[model samples]
Target: MPKAKETVLEIDLKALEHNYHFLKSKLKPNTKFLAVVKAFAYGSDSATVAKKLQDLDVDYFAVAYVNEGVVLRDSGITKPILVLHPQPVNFKTLIERCLEPSLYNAKILKEFIAVADAENQTNYPVHIKFNTGLNRLGFWESDTDYISEHLKATKAVKAISVFSHLAASEDLTEIDFTKTQIKNFTAIADDLSSKLGHTLWRHLCNTSGVLNYPEAHFDMVRCGIGLYGFGNAPEYNTELKPIATLKSVISQIHKIEPEESVGYNRAYTSNGYEKTATIPIGHADGISRQFGLEKGAVFIQGKSAPIIGNVCMDMIMVNVTGIDCTEGDEVIVFNANHTASEFASTANTISYEILTAISQRVKRTFLH
Candidate 1:
């Protein structure tokens, strides 16, 4: 591959497809697949990712906000979109765009009902979210009775599914906690379905849940990181292929003497003569400042070059003292060979953060 003139995020469609199919294979044939494409499809272009998944016949699409779903709908996405955290303010737009909202509380549930009724809509699909230990969002399991009574009174909205989020599905040590969550979610879902007088779709699995707890795969599974090429566990990660490869070119190189300092605040002082290379990507480009001065690195000519100073808004300096590299050489920030998970671990974060932190300004190249 040729060196890019500037930093670029190369999206591998084949790798995405591989991860998608691998995850799908883990599910029963009858189960539905909900691909989470929010946060710009985890920082990889939501419209593009949704289109590919749609082509693959993914059963549903989910976004964190209504605006994201509208973008997909406007782009010709006809599949059902579930807004994971729909605000009351966006209820009108969501209804107009035919985007389903996950009603987590009585306030939002009642508010959305009013909107649907004023619009003269009937049976507008809505998902009911229950608090199953994540304690982030969703109605209490006890609220099931309240939710059921509301649905009984309103014909404008219909509860299509009952779901909850797992708190620690990724940690094997938390298996017991995960099981307790699943058990509680199952009982609540069954009771809610009974109260509603119909069997509703029940989902309680995110990516890790889908990988670690197959028994909890109720009617559907929401896959976010797994589709982006991470399984949150080492063993499962090997079966998935990373879809994004962030690359840049060495803009310049310099030789510094002993006691010389580099970058803003002179954060790094050279103990001896050292060679450094500067790349055209920095905090503004989603390379966090915390990664400065030995905390982070970039791969050049298959060798690791440790960062030497504070990461600038649009540039970063790396120590390349012994590396056989030069200006214009390709630098791999993180790619298939250098996993994003490993890169994020160095900064005390996760791959999801690293992937989504990538700014939209970086040129995105798609490989079909």
Candidate 2:
């Protein structure tokens, strides 16, 4: 194995297992769990996370695209994989790989039904997504009749589950809106179940939903961020262990004088003589530009070193004054000690963006 060097993303499989079990415990008995591993398992390595979840006996895996499902299949994951935003073009490959698609709209439903029929597939599971409130994807409440009619007409396609996404399940301030969404989804699910005359698996909760809305657990729950640690709620933070940490080594150290400029465009000027350390991580490695010029920081010698000046493509300068840091010193950008959520908040973004936007070029080291 390559030794730890410049920038590395440390993945904690043990924490992943812990989060998985924590979320699983919140679900209703006999209810299934779908591990959402899309976007490279939220940019931490999908194959590794999926394999771990599979070993943990997760009932299903969900991805946002067919290619993501393909990744799981290639990794020898035998569990059912749900493609949330599958396009018609990948229908053939999806069937060949035994990957199920989430048919959201009439167009997708009709196209997938035709493809299934042509492929001689029977009871090939596909999910139906309803637009309860997110308004991002899924069929509208009014589109239910058309969807039902098409499903009835297509004998080849099988309705595996009916699901919706929560718009603001994490925001307690939006509890009313979240309740409205739940009500809408429940109404739509009831209508669809009655019309189909057969019960299909129902789910509408993400990690936040699993935590906040146990009454709406339905038949299954899809978990993404919760599995990676941050539960979108402050109370659950202590229960869930973060699965990934961004660490880098100090590449160089420099002495700065009072009134001296640092980094690009003189974004930061030293207040006095100070020691600065340059770390081998930057926007190219997923540290956003917004983190530059005092917005972001790294932990060194158990002390916080505020980032100085603009973040470069491959390097970030930190004011390491009064610190004993030297070249090759390990610096933590974000970890269980310094949560990614804090960095994200500094950047005016969410932890999901921070995790998912991590560049693929960085080295990943898995730890148990």
Candidate 3:
């Protein structure tokens, strides 16, 4: 893509395709690939990302809510979509949209069964989540009897899959804990299968688990960050390509004398005569305030320009001393090479937070 004339988040479809195939290479031939497109496909355009993945033939998609699934359906995403944290109020719409639900607890299970039965549905597919280690949402192994009994009593729903999340699959220091979680998930799936009188497919691996725990790559693997070109670890990141590159133009340049201040609250006072570039993105555009006062930087003409001042609601000032750049020059907030993860670290955050925090108001330019 050409250099940005204005602030834009360039979504590279080719890079996304590469990341998908790279992640797919880690799985067996039959292992299903589920792309997590929640949070607007990690703050890019969800419909565009999902549509591109759909063309690449991803086996499934997962979202956090019912309306996200509805968007996918409306975008002509026909693949099976799993609503990972569906609320009871949207259960009716969820069913109507043919989106599967992850029935994690007894309350959700009972509630969904009532709704599905009331809709006069038959053998509606549902995922049973086991709380192996990620205690966020899921049922206990001991609840298998309850789940089995509840499932047997109702023809309204059927167990399509059983899965769990890894709390720290990216951290090798937590290998033992992750292995235990995987073992627990396996055992729970087994007990649930026996009680349900049938064996259902299971998925227990997240992005890191897919790379680090091939043994636990059950029936399917769900990847979100990896699909967006982050592998959760430096080793794996080297193998994937980042898909989003945030670029903006240097709207203006100013000469600052010693003791002169920049940005809101007079946050940055110049120590020496310096040149500063004003960027159009600010906290409202997802660049955090914590990045101000020289904590973060933007690359100008291959040189690093440290952000100097309190990040404003709609702008940031970067020290551009000795740079050959001028107004209208492209400024890279984050790019595939420089990386959002690296940029986020300047603010003591993660790529997920930065990626998903990108406001929708920013224009998105897709690259094939």
How much is the lDDT of residue 274 in candidate 3?
A: 89
Candidate 1 wrongly placed segments (more than 4 Å): none
Tell me the spans in candidate 2 whose CA falls farther than 4 Å from its real position. 1-3
Q: What is the TM-score of each candidate against the true structure?
A: 0.99, 0.97, 0.99
The residue-by-residue lDDT of candidate 3 on 122-214, one tens digit each, is: 999999988887789999989999999999999999998999999999999999999999888888989999999998999989899999999
lDDT of each: 0.93, 0.91, 0.94
- Model 3: residues >4 Å from true position, as ranges? none
Measured with C-alpha atoms, the lDDT of residue 345 in candidate 1 is: 87
Model 2 lDDT per residue over 23-120, tens place:
99998789999999999999999999999999999999999899999988999999999999998999999999999899888788889999999999
> For candidate 1, lDDT tens digit of each residue in 185-238?
999988999999998998889999999999999899999999999999889989
> Would you give me the overall lDDT of model 1?
0.93
Model 1: how far residue 88 lies from native, Å:
1.2
Worst 10 residues of 1 by lDDT: 1-10
